[model samples]
Target: MGIVEMNKDGNFPNVRLLFDNDTGIDDALALAYLCACDHVQIEALTSTPGNVDVEQVAANNRALLALCERPEVPILIGAQDPLQIPLVTTPETHGPQGVGYATLPDRGTTASSEADAVDYWIDAARANPGELTVLLTAPLTNFALALRREPRLPWLLRKVVIMGGAFYYQGNTTPTAEWNTHVDPHAAKEVFAAYTAAAEQGLESEKLPIVCSLDTTERFEMQPEFLTRLAEEAGCTESELVLASDPEGTLSNSSNPLVRYLSDALRFYFEFHRHYDQGYIAHVHDYFAAGVAAGTLGYQSRPATVDVETESTLLFGTTVADYRGLWGKPANARIVSSNDPESGFAELLTRLGALARKLDTNS
Candidate 1:
């Protein structure tokens, strides 16, 4: 089942959220979507090393939050390296700065939260047990560490929506692994084991973790035409003008900061996909993960005993879903198989357009 059901008014309720990100292009876009959405109250942001170093990710988080006018949200720095393996970064996909072509304005002297990320996570869980949902859009290093500090963390969290792994689809990092999981397969393994242990100890099935793997996420692609239509609907004059002049380079000279930033960031992602997958579009992987966290997306899910491969050299980091119950273990996670992409994309654009309108007027 999904994280939440619709209310009598057919609307999802506002949810409190904690975000952990590596701040890549898609992560930035997801953050923008979450900040703009009224249905989620972002409690805090935690940074980890993945797309770039932890330091750069933290900086990107601060800058992006400032741009979204959400600098008040606590930014906490977390694991700088993986639990066991040396940290690997993907600067090639996301520009040298890890946020694509867009250069976010300096956030000045603003600093991140003094509280350690692990400490903050434990405290947040204690403060709002069974109420805080976590959106993990990066490696599982920080989360694994948090669980180590407080073994009861899985039981304390209301839900977890992970944007990692590749079950049925080909891996983006290696022949059998996704980037986030591959970056720190040991951590991923530990995390899955923790949840499995929690379930064995009698945590409710509904509270089990949910994963949005590459198989489902790769289905939602953002086309240029859709983005242009959204810009027009949002009345983004700058974006419209840019789209008119250089439709392909809509990121250049757009008056709408959000449009300009997102367009620029997406350009790099689009180019990567076009080169690798022969598609002139970008996948909304992390964005869909955020939607799941917000309980605003319709999807099909199956409960399964999931694990990460950490021992095999070639297949390390591969997400193994025991569909046949060969392991004879109780299900520990919900694997999302498919989603209503059309309606989901529509809702995404509607919310983004509303944010654009708000930013346009405020600017």
Candidate 2:
């Protein structure tokens, strides 16, 4: 089969996601979470050069899908560079291959004939009408291209859940901007303004198009034992494997290729957590964003007159305006701040076990 065969309804869900990944540990974790979730049907994946090169990002994506036993899923290669600015990468944070020290498989074949990611997105949105949700995790280049192809897209998409921007939160890339949004501020502005204006017009689809400068994913942290369990169940039970992807001590720019390889790198990725953030493991931020895309989690949202200030000295990029009082403007996006992490993670680990067994048998 084809993606169509996997669609539960006659048509795919409005939840069409686009990932311009750096191939970091969270990206892999997010991809695995999306694949394992039955509710979220990924229609397409698009890679960009941010943390890892475009080729490696694509390769990592392939290895991940194969590891999940869903290589048949379609993917489209994305732009080699950013929309307007020079490519900025973070090898120190995302590691050499973009994940924790992990291994990747060979790239076999293109999963889709729609090679141009922007065109693929445009066609998908047009074909699906008001049912296409664009979940962007990395940058906004692909989204900008899509809008350039069809100006009405901001109004047409079911929603756009973006995992970018830094509000009161300190920036991971710089003092004021987040990596994803800062990479392409022009594209971010277009997307932000388009969706904001559309919601002001009471467009139904715009009611949830723009999720703001929010990162609610800090709530979902997996325990060190959980990471050990995932690797152990994966048959790589050595404590070394656990230490490698520890999310703490694992250097973002490890020289050992196999240390951050996607296949067995989860340990080092987890180890990095022990060094940077609190505890031995980091929260699943992007993965939780994927959960919102799957509709598996609940959200509480309020409408506001949102704007991106192009002139803030500190926030040289755009900044969403202070939450204004109740206006007729619709809610183009939602923010999910909490979840049953214990139960949800347990469910995810359980599914991983089944998937691991399936891969083992097939191998």
Candidate 3:
């Protein structure tokens, strides 16, 4: 199949998205944004261990989908642990439940797809061929496993968007590594190498892979005032309206459940960041990666040979990019260097808010 062309409305084409996430607060926010947007059609959601365990990730995905009234999208459980290391979680940052203090209704007995995550990814790619965009927001274990099982996965994908790494910004895990890569350096290394090899063997450069590093994502900070505006514009005083009740029967004329859920979820994230980064703001890092895949966010990127350090005792998981051809390797990834967070945030809020109103009116 060829590229999924945009319709006459000049909006994004209905991109088929397969998301692999840890389902942390940020991931939840990203999911809400994705679900609210009209440009992409989510295919499946696969879980991994990062902010929480894989099981909890799946549960969160299911619960959030239920709240969004989109439980039709399948959830698939992924690797229980990293490829060569013990699983580590960041409960401190994302709270014990992985979504901060906000609790989602338990999707009791809500099961994921029986197929292994690796198999699901490979099969999805084969079915969609050149029309699948894979958004990876967690550790790369599933992706590595899938790539190993099927070497043609890279070429089959329309694009791969990674929400990890830090090219120039300080790392959030180690002084030199980001959390996602730090939790699974071996998997990250394997994925970079696989994409690099695929491109060197003749895959188109544009379809190689895109990395939304901390350098760019750290600039995106969700402000409380923005949330306030959303609430006020939606005719609600408190941002917790959507969080206070089940969305199915909630008065859709009041506010959007998507916006309410995001607002409620961000409270804990905002507090965490306030203490962690001395800023009372939440960074929805993964949202930019999704926007990049959707062609809604403009980014400045450059071709680079990006690699992850898997064995440096103190610097394990550090993203090493050969920006100057220092290692004499061809560029394999497009490292996003900059993006207008203000414009991006504006677009996200506008689109999501409009979606909420539409859903409300329909409801």
Ranking by TM-score: 1, 3, 2
The CA lDDT at 185 in model 1 is 89
* TM-scores, all models, native as reference: 0.93, 0.79, 0.90
Where is the poorest 10-residue window by lDDT in model 3? 243-252
- Which ranges in model 1 have alpha carbons more than 4 Å from their true place? 1-10, 108-115, 238-251
Over the stretch 1-363, how does candidate 1's per-residue lDDT look in tens digits? 444332335377879999999999989988998987887899999999999998788888888888788888988888879989898888778877788777886674544542488899999999889999999999999999998889898889999999999987899888889999999989988888998899889989888888999998888888766667667767866434322224443454667777777778877777767768657778878998988898888777888898999998889889999877899888888989778678878877888888877887887
**Pairs in clash, predicted candidate 3:** none
> Relative to the unseen true structure, what is the C-alpha lDDT of residue 303 in candidate 3, on a scale of 0 to 100?
84
lDDT per residue (tens digit) for residues 208-305 in model 3: 68889899898998876777667655555455333222332233232566565666667777777767755777888998887887777878788889
Give lDDT tens digits, candidate 2, residues 67-182: 67677766677777776668877666667777755666655655332247778888887888777666777777667667767877866667677776655566655676666777
TM-score of model number 2:
0.79
Overall lDDT per candidate, in order of appearance: 0.83, 0.60, 0.81
Candidate with best TM-score: 1
Q: Give the CA lDDT, 0 to 100, for residue 8 in model 3.
A: 33
